[model samples]
Target: MNLKYLIFIIILITGITLAEETKQKAVLVTGASSGIGLKVTEYLIKSGFYVYAGARKEEDLKRLDAMKNTTSVRLDVTVQSDIDAAVKFVQSQNRGLFGIVNNAGVGVFGKMSEVPDKDILWIHDVNVMGPHRVNRAFIPLLKESMGRTTIIGSISGYVTSAESGAYSMSKFAVEAYTESLADDLRETGIHVGIVDPGAYKSKIRAKVTMFNLTGSYDLNQELTEEQKKVLNAAKERNNKLKEPDEVAEAVIHLMTSDKPKLRYMVAPTIGAAEVTMKTTLGRVVQLNADQQFEYTRDELVAFLDELLKENSSEL
Candidate 1:
């Protein structure tokens, strides 16, 4: 090669390398005003990824935008116009999205027979349909970038107790949605996953309490003695619970890992994990009972071990 031509090639390669080194991946996180979403946003920023933090309130948008490498988008998961605007805004940035964390969710605790239909709908709108809407709107960009998408699920999908039917139902729906979505996108490079967190310190309970008592999101209303006790207990329990930083870590793994798992159950305690697993296994046992080809306990254990081995493989 001629000396001058070789030098020009060297300079061209160096410029390309510099450009690649400075490039940053962008991720959109819904419900980023507080709790898990906020933690994920902060951690992503710390890890040097650009973030489009989605929040509904004006103050939250301002706060998020003030962060380095962060842009706050006004996104209310239940509203289609807001979602469309968000999609447009993201496209306008021209960074091209790399990942999406569907973390916006709501919780309601009430008896199935007594909970108002509107309350159930409200929770479903935020918890279940929220992810669906956001996913549908952003899937084009995700496909363009071959990006990853994760929904923030809950172990409540597996273990439901009294007065948690609605919330549990929505989570169970998310579990199904994630599985089906993964299957649908199997050929695409886009990865789909869910992070199910257990009892992380969050504002979900406070919101639930306020909605259950006052039928609105307002927290300034007067409280009765019973309501006060409930709020106090919830506050105390939340203070005892750990932050959801691990859940944020799980999300980061899903976004960056070459071989990310489809499901990440992030429980705050071993007992919570055990209960959730047992509840899942109990359902399996129930399904086997009185069936034509019921498996024995040993057979089930062997099958579980086989599954574990398969999941451990680099597929």
Candidate 2:
């Protein structure tokens, strides 16, 4: 090869390498105080990405701040001032935001009729409006990056478990909003996607219990000992949930992949169940619908009986 051509090729390669090295790409994760959000922040930091870990609590933020190559910012998704402050902080960093993991959410478990209107509203505000608030605040940064935004949603967004009525409703709304946002942002080179995790162990279960206890709403008058037992059993099952790190791994993959998918369902059982519902049951709705109803009823009844018997023995 000619000397001139060799020098030119070397220059081109150097430019590419420099671009890769200095290219500014940042990931901002909400609810990074704990659970999946904290795990995601850790993974991103390990992978050498500039991460802004946003949380409502100052202590959690301080913990993340102690890590190298990570910035911790106070962000309460439910509060607009906090959201605006976080956005301003990111903008000041000048690294250019690339991804957003909207993991801040709360769940309220109860019968729809039994849950107070205030509790329902609060759940929706956090689960649905919280993401919206964060997105609106940070969308400019996402757009500036041009098509690299990932939103962390939940599997509950698609399927509704009867026991967590208010939670399911909020997640359902989130699913709709995510889909719509994906469509809206498609042409603008700003990708909007959702990660629907099935069951990952987190403080969310304890938070759910706390919400139940602290809620001003009264339990259903018709709720028999049997119904209470079933509810408690369900809560126990949730307590033995999957690890948050697994879901965090999924978030990292979504954020880093060149051709990231629009929707990613994390766990095996929940993913399979969602696919089956959409492909099998979804097609023949009414026919298999009754079978699903019978299955759930039978399981709930069995769970209730076992729980009640256990409680009676304890008494």
> Largest lDDT belongs to which candidate?
1
TM-score of each model, paired residue for residue:
0.91, 0.74
Residue 294 deviation, candidate 1, in Å?
1.5
Candidate 2 lDDT for residue 47: 74
Model 2 error, position 7 (Å): 29
Best by TM-score: 1
How accurate locally, in lDDT, is each candidate? 0.91, 0.75
RMSD of 2: 12.8
Encode model 1's per-residue lDDT on 1-315: one tens digit a residue: 999999999999998976663488889999999999999999998887899999988989999999988999999999999999999998998788989999998888888788788888888999999999999999999999999999999999899988999999999999999999999998888899999999998888787778877777766789999988887787787788899999999998898888998999999999999999999989999999889999989999999999989988944
lDDT of 2 by residue, 1-315 (tens): 999999999999998976774574788888888778888888888777888888766677789899877889888788899888888888887788888888887778877678789888998888789888888887877887883666667766666655777887887787789889888888777877788777776667655654455442223334457656655765687667766776777777777776666777776475655663574344444453567454464665677689779766643
Tell me which residue pairs clash in candidate 2.
201-242
**The CA-based lDDT of model 1 is what?**
0.91
